[model samples]
Target: MTTHVYFDGGTKNGTTRIDPPFDGDLYFQAGLFDKEERYLRTDEIQVVDGVTYTVFRFTA
Candidate 1:
C-alpha cells in the first residue's frame, strides 16, 4: 500500500499556518515535486494582517 499526503498551500485546516520548505520538502520526500506545483507570479507570496501565505492551485 502507498500513502500520499499533499499540502494544498496556505494555512493548514484554515487555522494554523503552513510554510514552504517544510511543506515543499514533504512533497519532494514523497517523490512528487520539490516546490510549489502551481502558483501566481503576480501574487507570489503575501502576508495578510500578520499571517504569511502563498496562493497555489492544484490542477486535476
Candidate 2:
C-alpha cells in the first residue's frame, strides 16, 4: 500500500519531519514548500483503530 506524507517545512539539520511516517519508499508531499516532492524513504507508522496506533508519533 502507498501512504501519503505531508511535511511541515520544518527541518532539523537535514531531515525534515513528516506526518504519518511511512515504511520504505513512499510519497512525500510538502505542505509549506514551493518545490516538488513526489516521494522519499521514511520510517513506518500505522494506525490501529480510532484512538490507537501502531507508532503514535504524529497526531494524525
For each candidate, what TM-score against the reference? 0.27, 0.26
- Best candidate, lDDT-wise? 2
Off by over 4 Å in 2: 1-13, 42-60
Clashing pairs in 2: none
Question: Candidate 1 — which residues are off by over 4 angstroms?
Answer: 1-43
lDDT by residue (3-55, candidate 2, tens digit) is 33333222311233334545554443445554434543335444333322222
In the range 1-60, model 1's lDDT, one tens digit per residue, is 112232344332122234334334222212244433432212334455665555343332
lDDT of the candidates, in the order given:
0.34, 0.35
Clashes of 2: 0
lDDT of the structure predicted as candidate 2:
0.35
